[model samples]
Target: MKIQFLNQEHETKFQELRLGMAEYYRNNKEYLSVVYIMAGNEELHRKMNRYFNTKEGMFSSDDMFNEEDFSSGNRILAKLAVHLFNDNETVSPLDIISALDDEWFQLALNAIHFRRYGISSGYDFPEEKLYM
Candidate 1:
């Protein structure tokens, strides 16, 4: 969605999410290729390449979301981002809403809501309302 995530930590986290999704598709090449077309800033594309090219093997979710690794958390975020970005009806806020559906985004949203409004998982606003 229309998140600025001005802070580097948040940005890095977002990137990690994207890399995670890309890695999944990378592993499922034949199936994923025909589905969604990935597009974003140059950095996002680069991260996707890195995750795709990463060596194949068994890795834990902790390892997948690590800043050092292409992380499952990151992949989760990426998958959400891709889904929102590809949706013709999605807009900026809707994109953020879509991203928040991811585990990483949920964590961020829960923290922010708890700190600012004392809410967790917050309100489940519809994507349609977000667009307006």
Candidate 2:
């Protein structure tokens, strides 16, 4: 399931992530050589390897999505960005619906991301539909 963030910074703040990421990489070039994020939790740390073809960086889960989907507009990327750019922002929500399921992880992840951005779920769990 999709979620509607109070501020919905995924669209606007993504630029922040892109800029911060660029700055981060520029400032610390060693991360390109080694940075570890669990599984798909931080795919970019993984993708950065493939995109650059570093000696030790050989796998990129980005293949899960096509090359064209590199932008942050993708829901997954948006979530990643929200968490990545988090700088002491806490975004709340208007309503949360679950069809009465106990799948709180989705809500937690969403809330956690929002907590980062000061703003913003998942399935009961399956296809998500977000409304503005």
Deviation in angstroms for 119 in model 2? 23
The residue-by-residue lDDT of candidate 1 on 10-38, one tens digit each, is 44543454355545443242212211112
lDDT (tens digit, per residue) of candidate 2 on 1-132: 133322333323332332334432422222211221111224443444344333332333344334524333223333332333332222233222322122323433454444333311111312443523
* Residue 103 lDDT in candidate 1: 39
Per-candidate Cα lDDT values, in order, are 0.35, 0.31
Best by TM-score: 1
Candidate 1's C-alpha runs over 4 A off are: 1-3, 6-45, 49-70, 87-103, 106-132
Q: Compare the candidates by lDDT and give the number of the best one.
A: 1
Error of 1 at 75 (Å): 1.2
